[model samples]
Target: MPKAKETVLEIDLKALEHNYHFLKSKLKPNTKFLAVVKAFAYGSDSATVAKKLQDLDVDYFAVAYVNEGVVLRDSGITKPILVLHPQPVNFKTLIERCLEPSLYNAKILKEFIAVADAENQTNYPVHIKFNTGLNRLGFWESDTDYISEHLKATKAVKAISVFSHLAASEDLTEIDFTKTQIKNFTAIADDLSSKLGHTLWRHLCNTSGVLNYPEAHFDMVRCGIGLYGFGNAPEYNTELKPIATLKSVISQIHKIEPEESVGYNRAYTSNGYEKTATIPIGHADGISRQFGLEKGAVFIQGKSAPIIGNVCMDMIMVNVTGIDCTEGDEVIVFNANHTASEFASTANTISYEILTAISQRVKRTFLH
Candidate 1:
């Protein structure tokens, strides 16, 4: 591959497809697949990712906000979109765009009902979210009775599914906690379905849940990181292929003497003569400042070059003292060979953060 003139995020469609199919294979044939494409499809272009998944016949699409779903709908996405955290303010737009909202509380549930009724809509699909230990969002399991009574009174909205989020599905040590969550979610879902007088779709699995707890795969599974090429566990990660490869070119190189300092605040002082290379990507480009001065690195000519100073808004300096590299050489920030998970671990974060932190300004190249 040729060196890019500037930093670029190369999206591998084949790798995405591989991860998608691998995850799908883990599910029963009858189960539905909900691909989470929010946060710009985890920082990889939501419209593009949704289109590919749609082509693959993914059963549903989910976004964190209504605006994201509208973008997909406007782009010709006809599949059902579930807004994971729909605000009351966006209820009108969501209804107009035919985007389903996950009603987590009585306030939002009642508010959305009013909107649907004023619009003269009937049976507008809505998902009911229950608090199953994540304690982030969703109605209490006890609220099931309240939710059921509301649905009984309103014909404008219909509860299509009952779901909850797992708190620690990724940690094997938390298996017991995960099981307790699943058990509680199952009982609540069954009771809610009974109260509603119909069997509703029940989902309680995110990516890790889908990988670690197959028994909890109720009617559907929401896959976010797994589709982006991470399984949150080492063993499962090997079966998935990373879809994004962030690359840049060495803009310049310099030789510094002993006691010389580099970058803003002179954060790094050279103990001896050292060679450094500067790349055209920095905090503004989603390379966090915390990664400065030995905390982070970039791969050049298959060798690791440790960062030497504070990461600038649009540039970063790396120590390349012994590396056989030069200006214009390709630098791999993180790619298939250098996993994003490993890169994020160095900064005390996760791959999801690293992937989504990538700014939209970086040129995105798609490989079909």
Candidate 2:
């Protein structure tokens, strides 16, 4: 394929590997690492990220849905993949793709078991998600009896692991709550194991959990944002390298007279005689309208250019009055100097939102 001539999201594979090794080094020798590659690997291209992680000998891969796992599988990924929220409609395809599902409720459990039985599958591996404290999706502690019964009834399927999510592992102030969650999850895992008379791998640590609670890192640790470079803590920022950099080029430049308005709805007016550089990127390209009207800015010539005016569907205007540049000058949206977290903070959102909100229409270029 010809190289893209417009905006591009530069993905750094070496930085990805570096983050993976950094997290791995922190874990116990026996602790497994599962790289979360959902939302197109946090909008950086799942197939590429999964392929790199696979080459890195990652213990496992995880996605939010069955189709995502299928994507990885079709891309020649052979490692075990956990589907965090598999729906009943795709159970057949999931099974066919050798994707494991995290059974969170009794209804899903029974439904999946029936499908597994009809398919005449033996020992189909599945993971059970317990609701430790997230209160999102997962079986509640009170539903343990139902889980025990279901496991015993579905002898055709194998319970490979029992896992729960920590709701606030990133907040050190919530240590007591975190400990309570771990304790509850451990108790439930132990109870289930005893009743089922089988050993089930138990996991409760995400990136933050792994960093804060070593004891909760039972059999595996699921690292998502951390693997992409954010450590979920201020202290680890210096150690992790961001893996994605967004860049675009100036499409045109216009000189604005003082008191002259710019862009749709005249959201911004020139404070003084200044130069405005319009870039071929906007809300349609995942740069939200919130970024317009002075909320967002980009870096040009190693200096910040404040965005001015309403963000249009296909373009935005940046104040480049004094920047030594012309049409086609390179602009950095986020990079080593200006991180995604900084951008997110400026946009009043989170890093995950900014990362995943990147539109697929934007071209992706990988750099080792």
| Maximum-lDDT candidate | 1
After superposing all C-alphas onto the true structure, candidate 1 shows an RMSD in angstroms of 0.8
lDDT of 2 by residue, 1-368 (tens): 22234789999999999999999998989988999999999989999999999999999999999999989999999999999999999999999999999999989999999999988899999999999889999988888788888888776698999999999999999999999999999999998888778999988899888788888899899999998899878788778999999889999999989999999888888889999999988898889998888888999888899888988998989999899988877888998679999988887998898899889999999987
The local distance difference test score of model 1 is 0.93
Cα lDDT of model 1 by residue, 262-324, tens digit: 999999999899999999999998999989979999899899999878999999999999999
In order of listing, the candidates' clash counts read: 0, 0
Model 1 residue runs over 4 Å out of place are none
Worst 10 residues of 2 by lDDT: 1-10
Tell how far residue 224 is off in model 2, in angstroms.
Answer: 0.2
Clashes of 1: 0
Residue pairs with backbone atoms closer than 3 Å in model 2 (clashes): none
Residue 229, model 1, lDDT: 94
